[model samples]
Target: MQKRQSKHKGKSALAEKLCPVCQRAFSWRKKWQRDWQNVIYCSKRCAKNKITKEPKPCE
Candidate 1:
């Protein structure tokens, strides 16, 4: 049987667990399993806004 690690031992950092855009806790699911780290926004709209605000790749 697959064992779940202790919450305190694995991915326990609160800063790494929240969405940067909405500041909401991330809901774990199969879809989010892979992009958990890159998940800055809770939704696509926020992600778009972040990209749009950027003047360019390099200034």
Candidate 2:
């Protein structure tokens, strides 16, 4: 006999975002739920690199 299926199974269609640094697609995560709008980089590495590439102020 076949087992019963869950109603919520395979329904977790998470949102996706594009990473500016790697130019790749990334999916939404639970930790970012509250600050999804504020999220920019997909990982810490990307965020760190972002700040390093900023233009320097005039001396």
- Listed in order, each prediction's TM-score against the native is 0.41, 0.65
Error of 2 at 55 (Å): 4.5
Off by over 4 Å in 1: 1-16, 51-59
Candidate 2 segments exceeding 4 Å error: 1-12, 51-59
Highest-TM-score candidate: 2
> For candidate 2, lDDT tens digit of each residue in 10-43?
4257788888887878888879999999888999
- lDDT for model 2 comes to 0.81
TM-score, prediction 2: 0.65
Name the candidate that leads on lDDT. Answer: 2
lDDT string for model 1 (23-54, tens) is 77765545777777666677787677554555
